[model samples]
Target chain A: MPMTTTPAEPVTPAGPTVPGEPAAVAEPRRRRRAAAGWVLLPAVAVLLVFFFYPLATIVWSSFTEPTVGLANYTALFTDGVSVTVLLRTLRTALIVALVALVVAYPYAYAMTRVSRRTRAVLTVLVLLPFWTSVMARNFAWYLLEQRDGLIDRFFSLFGIDGVVLLGSVTGVTVAMVQVMLPFMVLPLYSNLSSIDLRLMDAATSLGASRPKAFARVYLPLSLPGVVSGFSLVFIVTLGFFVTPALLGTPQQSLVSQVIETRVGDLLDFPGAGAMGSVLLAVTLVVLFAVSRIAKPTAALNQAVDRA
Target chain B: MPSTRAGRPRSIGWGLRLWVTAVAVLLLAPTLVVIPMSFGAGQTFAFPPKEWSLRWYEEFFSSPQWMSSVVTSAQAALLTGVLATVIGVAAAIGLDRGRFPGRELLRSAMMAPMIVPGIVVAVAIYGTFLRWHLNGTLLGFVLAHTVLAVPFVITSVSTSLAGYDSTVEVAAASLGASGWTVLRRITLPLLMPGIASGFVFAFVTSLDEVVIALFLQTPEIRTLPVQMYDSITLEIDPTIAAASSLIVVVTTVALLLPQLVRRRRSES
Candidate 1:
């Protein structure tokens, strides 16, 4: 009788109870909701201790070491070697990014034109290198580009003998472009695939030549991918260590190499910290500048969505 | 859309197709060359490697030093995968379900590792870990690699979480299910794919990571990639080709396993 009474009573009462619950339940639920955010504490804590704190230490050491007041910062400008290396890094990254873009655009376009089966094959080709280890790929390049390696031997058949590739900027750039083409192609392919084919047909029917139609219709829509891909390639190349380190000589050392030498060889913590901070600053500035110009946030989201 | 007009511009299309094929070959050539080169009969890296031999593979498999580095790398990668996934999944769930101030800022902060250059991170970690006396320690390797690997996990888990419906959790709650039960029965099952992928990704990232390992490496401890780096830069040995091919095979298999699992699940 008690169980039956409880069940029967609640059936009628529950309908009215729901309407009356908000006043009592709202405050406590809101408080509970806020407390749930603390679940992020462990991750935030780990990163703070390991990531942000270390970075802060580097930034702090840059000023405080060997007497304070911007000496390291000033030395970045005054020291010819540091400045030259920084400039060279920027120059080389730009060259690599542009060259990769040139190679990737056509490949990505071809991917869009192909059938699904063919596209899958092309994608695997692009991804094979990406999935391979950087050390392995760079080593392959090292063997091929060495003085009497495959590339040079092949060049000899064309009467272009004794060409120097290894230990040169050309060798480093070639390897980098190969390594980075996937980064360029994937973004460009996603952007291109999303494009409507009719727009090209529409532009061509409106009396624009094929190239003209592509420039006016396709190129503008594809600009977002281009900007995102180029910046991604450039930023990654800026901090590249493996390819440049193996293929390049001291004369062509990038800023990352500079940082490594300062810390490892010279034991110049503050000097290396200064260089690291500068590189970080430049990367952030470039990232923000690109995001501002091209809505890279949207492009990045699209890329991630497709992935 | 214009298949009927395809023959109008045949020459240019032919040329473009050829160029794209060439680019694909260029991308594949470097990685493929290692397969043949790894079998070089000569001591040095040589083109067309005069004769085929498995001596380098024997060297890789037989050398205690090389085998130990492989073991060390695998141990670190396994630890990194577990640590990063636990931390990353919690952060992703918190971001998804919690409504609080600075939530966007926290999300970006979690992702910052991916954007920050690797060498910059390596230098920062090296400098800090040196002072903390963490350099070259196994704990140091796991912690530092976790910092790099966590972002990938967060990205993967967040993507999966974005598609999850919260109304089912609310329904389970109203039926008197405990919070943990709802998470275990409803949420975790849906998120299993993401978690698995995240684990694999973190593992591969640690295995592939060289810059940080290079800085943090002690003479007592070294990862396979660091060993390969030394072998290539400090000495040009054919044994490195064997190591590289092994890495390529292992990583490709690791990356493909998740997709295969998903395909099987969908089919069933």
Candidate 2:
């Protein structure tokens, strides 16, 4: 196996004695290599037993339950409520990604232009919300969107009266955009900062207008960041549970809500498992597609590294 | 137009800064709003409170149900921190020091939990835990949360290990120090900051986690987030605002503490 070969080749010459001593030294080095591999066992075992095992069980049940053979999958496709929720979930994710991108772009751009002290403050503003509990942030939104609450009262002052945001798609979208904005900003900022400002200077020196220089020289360069940020926000919004559940009503229910309902209220385990499987599959597919276009992991690591 | 070229971008920069400031305000609004709301004397959540008091905070402290959930969350988070850091540090060392085929794959698999949607993992665990009868147990909560928390620990520890010079271990070994001795005396002490930060990250992750906790919660066992969720969805009590504010303060402090320490260390 490649596993045995890769470590053995390097360790052979580095064995306990001179390079000429082959058989005796090779044995202990091999044993050490094997022992090093065994260090991975606890983590691997934990993941297998607790993480992958449960996930596999869910996939298994989705196939086998209710006298199996694709029944659940078929039902998921044919069921009107399920299909609508699935589509709505996708649409919501797309909207949240786009909205967050639009809102985050100028801020992330401005971050690149700011002094180091100002940029540090801006980064904290971005990350504070990111680190706060999802439930806390959602609860704050829930209160704000309620009738005669902060949002409604603020709107009423402008003569925009009787507009209820709670339980509406607007409220859910606003909350999600707020929650996902940091995800968009961090990656975009990392990518933007890495770009050499000299490129813009060069374009300007070539007699390109500032806007033209930005569009032609800068935007395309930051495309990888945009792609990475969009996919990150979209995938996270796809499975968003807390904000929507707290703020949205049945009319605006997303797929996670449906999964929660199926499992939590209805006690339909296999059905929920099928929905989860679909969500997981779609998430992985989107990640795979995004990876083809941009290195999401590199963007993520850069952002985290900056933080 | 020479002056225009120089002045135009500065003008745009000012406008962008204004826009960015507005966005920052919008981002901070929820956290800032909740703190004042937590002090509202009214029974229900209302803005610009006519009365301000600490009744809700007192309520949160006095209520056994709320207090118990706090205890439960702390216990689970603490256990998860210890368990995840130990396992994650071992995995990181193995991956960093040991070169073999499938090492990349193993590392990716370790990180899969972070990418997979939380609800899917929650549902999967909920289903399997139902069979294992681990649904409401503390061990169940720790194990499931550790699965989620380990990835962060690994990421943090791995970053630290990347800067670490492994030849130090080779030198120690050559000087007659054993493997365990080298790890104990040399490697771990050098990696202490990363491991500590990883522990805090794991703790915060488990503390903030709600999806798996939601699935695992029973009447007898509920974490703070799950309880807060129930309060928001099922009741209109403003005590949750108090609870939420507390979490915001505590988590911000916890998250920033390591950075502060690191900065001070660098300065020194």
Candidate 3:
């Protein structure tokens, strides 16, 4: 609006009032776009080579590395322990996602009610552990859960023993939930902040209790966050190797450790590749299922359409 | 929330205050332990540490081995920070400022590296590099970490650019400026905070990374985390405490730059 109008006219040039001049004017725009493509082609090429190729390479390696033809993937299903671990991994992922929501939603809601400075500080604290090395976090948890660790001392002070939270599946699950809580929290906080407080007030004025107001007015409104958080934590939790490796006993091994053992300890490249392929297959199927649930673009449309 | 206003949680509720204080202290438990451990007078990794001394800190400064790993990690982090930030800033601008095909796909791909398990990527890259004979080298670590760190740069810089208006660039261009000139003169200043945030994030990620360092580590070139891993897993010692404290200090500074900016922004 504030522009000197002459410059705008030259770019768009009430063009083609003179037909030959239209092509002259359009030519540079086309070339500029074409030039952009040329500039972008190298980046796209890098992605294809680095990102796309490795994904395909692992898939192919699974099949062809050892005497060819589905041996690796087939071996995973055929091996009972592998199948069990995959199932356990999925189970753990779901539980983590569930626990993250349970823990994060209340905190996020509380965050929204707090003053900006308080929220900022809290958000920083929530993000603090994340900023540190995951290894460091895991080690800290290890220390806390150890026999002589702080938590153990506290429990022992209360005269409790035989408490094995660190090396158990439960310990790993709790750690995983802690690890993924921020993923669940941030999206919810975004959606929650966007909500006008009046909706809850309106619900309350109409005789709804706090829980009722949250359920009827807030929950449906925040479905996008729930979906996003669930998918994110679930997908990430599916790929986790570190927490399990650090916290879980041998029996609690995840698919990642299996693959690592195969490749690193076993030197069975084909088997490792095959296991990777199987995990990839499951991930794709699970991802598709999640995308269906997330309906991300559709959710945006729904939000837009709501307005 | 306001129902509890007069006699409850926010006002005269000492119980609530106590709970909040307790929770905050509980949250800080792990971080606080680092200090006591750092000051351990004993050679063991014990809490309450038997006594209090700065011997480990002295050892950290005196030991060339620990210092070299710190130097290597810093170099790698700096290189990764710059590389990731440049590529990330370019990609962020390209995505936000330019309309292009497959933009969403390109973005998802760019951000995907961060989501991929560090071990998986490390192992995959190790496998790839083995065939190309790219292992056991600093360049390999740099390239691998640059890839790992790019997603953070992209996410942060993208969010920063979200607050940006592209019409300014268009206006600049229409005012007879070239694209590069418009970007240099109009865009860079606004994006500086975001780029710096991304830079810090990249540095932190590079510094803290261990899984990738593990598979890529050779005697010739290894980072702090790798050394920590080797030290702890092989021979437990007090030196590790000093190293951890030092990284924590550096990391706290790096991580807080964006926070300071945020606080300043909020204050203004």
Candidate 4:
């Protein structure tokens, strides 16, 4: 009777039904939804096995391996090189984030002011580096920053002779700013484009000069985008590996390089895991703080959709 | 949009325009520089090659090591694309329509891979893969890459899903069509463009990925990016210029492919 009932039942939401047969009528729809729920299973299962399991393993090892009770984590602070590297990495990330913001803010603002076609071209410029291979870009910087390379030669034109950028923290910082520019621009553009230009005119008409109006009205409105973009770049630069490894010297290595050496060369899994945990903790902390102000993920998704 | 002043144009001033142009040039310099550098005939990794030749390209194609790495990368990317898309699209649909209690949590979890730092991911996966015997294997690379690629696929597919009207699907189902029939005739066609783009994104994510691949690589199973990394760090190989150019061309075409597909679908 149950099987036959499903076959004869009207599937339409508007179809007439007996007064007391609501449960029977709703049964097939619920069954259909439950069937659709099965589709989520494979993805959840795969992530559970492949993604979460591995991450959990590292988190576990950080505390458990090489004897438990926080020995590994304590070493991260007591070890001279690790603490210094962590601090330097944070300093470099802050500098990169600030420089990228200064460079990207005007470009993103200009993107909002341009004609439609010109705006599209500007958008591509921001995305161009994003799609470029990381190794390739780092290699390009390696060539330009080498001793007596183009950068040095150009500096020499101003009588700043014998300047070498390669193997210096300055070189790594310069290359990273370039790599991080797109991340900063996309979010800022998305936020800036949505702002009404009429508001700026309104401020100017209210007895304010152009620069004063921009500083007072426009800057506050754009803070959400700025914070998210700045935080995103800062978080990414903190864990950077390739650019620093290629363009920077061992003495100037960032946190990522330290982690790499511990894990890859030293095979010190517990120590590497502890340092990685700290990096993850820092990233999550920044992400949470930024999420309180702006929706980085949504802004990122919107930017990608537009692209 | 007109200017308040008689002679003042209502557009960005020259200062901002010049600044934007400079920033754009800085953004594009690395990609633009690599193409010319790829043509250098000399041994040094210099720009504006004194001698122009295709020697690096010849070397890239002629060497078995370079060719094998390319083949391995392609194989891994292809598998990652397929795996990520199938599961990612399904999850997107489920999250979009299915009534679930933890839907928001699930969505965030799906995007977690994108936010997690690459070095942490590499170390974590490398540690577990050592125990799982997945280290230095193609399957290992594909699995690890799929985790990263899934987020891109999910984002692209979810974007397409946002514009999709589900009422049409309901209409089909109420007209005596089976669920499978409705999905096959309605949902797949509408979601094809998104799915295609998601596939492209997944492919590119895997191909461009380096940190995780760098750890997983063995002498026998190196991907192109890893090989490129070695060529630079171990020794300065001008042949990497050729490889970099090839990657740029390949990625440009791959990223552009979905846009082309969407255009054709719209025109038809």
Candidate 5:
């Protein structure tokens, strides 16, 4: 957190909490137990009402409204456009995650070698775009990548409009990359910052080139953060709506957009629910697989501080 | 970023430094372009304007619709900040201290709103709120944003809680202090940074949010991102630039101020 100078300690919140009054020492334990139970109910209610209920409703609606079974899913799997769009969503997410890593690794490497002051500034900068609405920032990329837009003008001087991006998959990828880059960068930076500098130094002193040192030592050590970042971008990208909506043609719709159209355009709640249930199932499977290997503290970049 | 440490080169191989710079820039190009494009001063969004003008700047301020929308967004963001911070902080504290059943599952469930697609929530809220007669009110937007935003508050506040030293409270307890005193004097101060982090995240989440806003906002109560969405689809004038510019300024300020404070806090 930008509020402190050192790595914070992990102390669970149990101190001096309503338990140590002059004559109330004995009374506080019972009250503390009561308080803990009280906390449990609200937390449980919030998660259930907001999360499990909606998701379960989606699953129930998908199978029930259209008739309970994986029939909707069966239709999805057997249909021409359905499987293609699903695969496209996953493939695009993978590409975005891969590109973001390729770009973030070096920036993170340079960042790890910086001073505290510079590190803070860079961290803030990395997070600033994230702080703004991704919709707006994605629009910024849209404007930049628009045909004959800002980026096009620069390339125009060299007779290169074809290279300019507007509605192509590359344009969508570029915008999505920008939106997801911070997701990739922050974790990598934090992980690198947390790395012991001695290892890198030792690797270099042993005659490994900088790249070699980074590849052999820094890279391996930072695997958790890398995996964390990739999963962060990957999962979010799977459910992405705006980037593809703004940048890609109708044919290029990802699963999220398909769900959006099914819900918003067609008013087929059951079909939409079916699509959502599928995505949720896939996400849980992937995340479970990821948790099996590396858990990003079960936090999972929650909403871009991220989040 | 010739990233050396402590007044000396970090022993990084020179051959790799350029490679790093090139990739970083290539990666960071989209971020860098916002500056120049933001300064573009023509009627069109052409990157390098034929002529420089502050007319869009003037237009953004003078347009009542744009001005009012900006105000609406700030209002929503402010409300989201307060509600999310309070509820999120409370949840974080409870989760950190208490170990009841299904706590892990609860945490995951609460965090799912953030991970789930905004459109999914938008659709669900649209249907739910329409039934509740909450279709186009500021209250609906707040409640929706708050739900989406709780995870940020939880994560950021929990980040702070994780760093908190339970021993301090223990010391306070041993010294004949009550829980209230220990929390007031010791815990809150230490957790200020994390709390601030939660607050900022909440603010930004509300501001940048469009999916939920789309389903919620009436012409009577459009937030900035919602307004931007309308402008993007409804009209193609330079006024949206003015809107974009205002958002850019406010967002940049929001992003920079905490770092400034945090930097000053640490340095002094």
Candidate 6:
């Protein structure tokens, strides 16, 4: 509801006017609202019939398909593969969120302090990946992560050997962290820029050390943004498919890969549906929980709109 | 905030500055590496190719499969962009101009495609399209992608509408212009930048999307990304580098086109 980033929508001022205009204005207003309703019908109807209906069918099949009980959901737990992949997926998502937060916080903080031109450049850098093709970026990561590639060479210089990033969870995580950083930075920047830095200044002036002042004041205030950023990154990484599939081996598969296999190779629609349903549930729950503390919608809008 | 006496800028120390620079490099370098790799003369996925040529680009341009996929992708993206812009512009106008019950609810519904995970939508749409026999069709690609692309259009148009002055429409109406004419002559012109941006974003969104495209792809009707994906996973061909660079360049220009348009509009 706190669409803080967007300016308020202006009310239309083209309502009907007549010489005797009191009661007649009400009828025209009703007609205008109806006209607006008509304008809205096409897009809304298309999404509902195409998008939501399909989504619901898949979720429904998770329950009703293959004998109409909780079998599919129960199988997800009892089946060793789904549970392991689910746990690995959760663990990977958490690591990506934490790592992105560490990198993004200071970068976002710097964005606030820099001169306007510098800020513009930094903003462009942050957004560059967002605009770049996803497959292209992933391809570049593949080139770097492949055997004896740049990453291996970098590690070799430090006397570390056989450090192949490809076909491993590490490769996927490294690529994913880059993918998720913008999501983290934009929200954190939005939150950080709004914080009254004077609080830190006030604390330092009161004889508190600068570090302690920041710890007690700035860090706490930035938590909402941190929470928002973490959840957003976490939720996205949960259902990530392309990166893990491209960089990772089947032996170290994430939940997304498992879901893909179930639907694509195995043709186990019910099973895949169940897994997809759980992924959707987790995403929504995390978003809902974050919404309570921070304006996830506002954070998401800032991240997406980059305004 | 700087404490009036010490009116220098906020003291972002060297450590933070260094970290930010490193982060910026980390964000940008990987994507840029593809450009050079794209022009590599070698067959293997080698960096700093011992020799250099546009061999891969030549291959990409010559291969019928790649060419056909390119055609499919271009057609889908163009269709998705146009269809989404129209529906989204209408929805933005509806949301902006109308005061109705559940208006906020409807607005949130428009954004749902963005919130839902890509793979989920891909599978769901894949499954549903299968039942409708819509899979492997341009209409399928367009409809699925339009769902994804519409949200971008809606957001862009809504942002533009937020800053728009509705009084111009009122002025036109008071001068006895018809509702449709006022909208056509005044409202649409004022919102052109937003509308243009919305179209570009939608175009780019459809152009770059791969998850849903992958699900809906058939051997006969696949897109460039599906080809690029196959080249990566199914084969070790380096020609994907050329395709990747081309895509990155195209999408970057498409995304920036709006910014340039807006800047030019403001200057004019």
Question: For every candidate, what share of the true interface contacts is present?
Answer: 0.53, 0.53, 0.07, 0.51, 0.25, 0.59
Evaluate residue B75 in candidate 3 and report its C-alpha lDDT on the 0 to 100 scale: 89
Q: Residue B11 lDDT in model 4?
A: 80
Model 1 residue A182 CA deviation in Å: 1.5
Model 2: CA > 4 A from native: A1-33, A295-298, B1-12, B254-268
Minimal lDDT window, size 10, model 5 chain A: A1-10
lDDT of each: 0.80, 0.83, 0.66, 0.83, 0.70, 0.83
Calculate candidate 6's fnat.
0.59
- The best candidate by DockQ is 2
- Tell me how far the alpha carbon of residue A32 in candidate 5 is from the true structure, in angstroms, after superposition: 2.5
Work out the TM-score per prediction: 0.90, 0.91, 0.85, 0.92, 0.85, 0.90
Clashing pairs in 6: none
For residues B87-107, could you state the per-residue lDDT of candidate 4 as single tens digits?
899888877767767788889
lDDT of 5 at A126: 70
Q: Which ten residues in a row have the lowest lDDT in candidate 1 chain B?
A: B3-12
Candidate 6 local accuracy as lDDT?
0.83
lDDT of each residue in B129-208, candidate 3, tens digit only: 66766676777767778777776776676777778885576566666776456557887887887787778778877888
Candidates 2 and 3: which is better by DockQ? 2
How far out, in Å, is residue A76 in model 2? 1.9
DockQ: the better of candidates 3 and 6? 6
Error of 4 at A209 (Å): 1.6
Winner on DockQ (1 vs 2): 2
Off by over 4 Å in 6: A1-30, A206-208, A303-307, B1-7, B251-268
lDDT of 6 by residue, A162-253 (tens): 88889999999999999888889999998988887777768778867777877898899999999988988888898888999999989999
Predicted candidate 4 versus true structure: per-residue lDDT over A50-116, tens digit per residue: 8899998898988998787799988877877888898999999999999999999999998888776
- Sorted into a CAPRI-style docking class, model 2 comes out as medium
Better of 4 and 6 by TM-score: 4
Estimate, for each residue in B1-268, the C-alpha lDDT of model 6 and write its tens digit: 2344321355677798899999999987888878889888987897767788999999999999999999998999999999999999988888986776778888878888887877888889999999999989999999999998888888888878888987676566556675667667887898887788789789878888888889899888988888888898888889999998887787667656766686689779
Q: Compute the lDDT of residue B264 as modeled in candidate 1.
A: 86
